[model samples]
Target: MDGLRLENEIEGEKTILMLKERRPIRHIVNIPKTRNTFCKGTKCRKHTPHKVTQYKAGKASLFAQGKRRYDRKQSGYGGQTKPVFHKKAKTTKKIVLRLECTVCKYKMQLPLKRCKHFELGGDKKTKGAALVF
Candidate 1:
């Protein structure tokens, strides 16, 4: 009942009641620096320790087919070739973790839930600890 809201309405001797609960959205998410998971590498197909890091996309290649086509289409005297995307619906991007197997050096990607803020190798949270100002 801490974050609950109740409403009652009466119409023609009929009573209607409604209850709603509100929860705050979490902002920050902390992840560990390393993880022990199953490695799918040919050399190491067993559970092993892996170094964890946030996955980042590399720079786009200019020689790619899409980039080459786009560049060629824009080379002419055209104001705008394609419609620019403006209707972005998502507020947060899914976080991807890059895990590398320690023994075989095999890398794999693991996607996580979307969060407003992501922290890598952050401090652990202790229960019942007083909040520091």
Candidate 2:
């Protein structure tokens, strides 16, 4: 049967299994440029306005201990010393928001759920408005 399975048992019992249908959900998220939240900075410990931005990882340093050790092990005419990784499973990355306190200029990071579409400081949505092309 379509999307259905039937199993027969030896004890004269029959079972019916129904497979769940999967649906893809597409949602677009929009965030504002500024936020009002509590700041944990030493100077500003109360609620304050924060500037919001997307957090990006900095460049990796070649002089790090791990990099140095790897480079030293790789130089001596030996093939790949370590196994390369190829088993990546996740398709989307978690979004991180960087919030900076306006008064103290202190920065903090907040992680968000994974989403297919992400928008920062995009246009605001109005109620009862038609979709524009």
Candidate 3:
């Protein structure tokens, strides 16, 4: 607290609304990820050779410490048990488009339309659905 400045302050009430963990990892190049370079065993603290594992679509990550940095729960001493974000967020791709309809040969367009045969954005009933989006 002497030299460090806390940019964002967390209130106890806000924890209920924002239980999910979120990280401000915008780009990869910004991260200080150690590659396959191993510190010399005699001099290095952890003389393990860490391979340059590219971050997949949030898959089974190898970096255990890196993952925990994204989650922080402060409650009564240890704080209340926080909800896991894995249940909420799905496997979303920034570039790739996922179709709700696997059978339909139609493509999900920019301006998603309500097609009787295809579901551009996954709607229960296609009736009266004229591109609600």
Candidate 4:
């Protein structure tokens, strides 16, 4: 014996309506501040505390081989040497976590699932209350 559950068709889709004040449901999609996982470094081969951080790409060097080649090709004439990519397919980049072992200071990257929005160490969401943005 619980709340009343009724099924009704609306807009060609069957929806279930529950009339009761029950426990709120939440969807957890955020990674916590810290995590304890296995470290594959030479110093620590066991599980250790790891500091989680978002992975970011480093600045591209100007003296790279590819850059040098491209510069050489576009030095004199010829408008636009290589083809510039314009058709981007993906809307959001995949999130990557940088896990650093506190014991040995070893760092490794872990890729996460694709999501439209991702927050690291953000505030937890509570049911029935408006999000604080």
Residue 84 in candidate 4 has what lDDT? 95
How close is each model in CA RMSD to the real structure?
4.9, 5.6, 21.4, 9.6
Summarize candidate 4's per-residue lDDT along 1-133 as a digit string, tens digits.
5788989998899999998856433233588878999999999999999999999999999999999998999999778978999999966677899999999999999998666777788877678997565
Per-residue lDDT tens digits for candidate 1, residues 1-133, read: 4444555556646554455655444589999999999999999999999999999889999999999999999897967898999999978888999999999999999998888999999999999999998
Model 4: lDDT equals: 0.86
Candidate 4 residue-wise lDDT at 118: 73
RMSD of 2: 5.6
lDDT against the true structure, each candidate: 0.89, 0.89, 0.35, 0.86
In model 2, the runs with Cα more than 4 Å from the true position are 1-26
Kindly give the number of clashing pairs for every candidate. 0, 0, 1, 0
Kindly report the root-mean-square deviation of model 1 from the true structure over all alpha carbons: 4.9
- Estimate, for each residue in 1-133, the C-alpha lDDT of model 3 and write its tens digit: 1233324447743322223444343222221223223333344434343322222254667457745654443423664465656666533323322222222222221222222232222334557777765
Better candidate number, 2 or 3, judged by lDDT: 2
Candidate 4's TM-score reads 0.72
Point out where model 3 deviates above 4 Å. 1-65, 70-77, 80-133
Evaluated with TM-score, which candidate comes out highest? 1
Residue 115 local lDDT, model 1 = 84
Q: What is the lDDT of residue 103 in candidate 2?
A: 98
- How many steric clashes does model 3 contain? 1
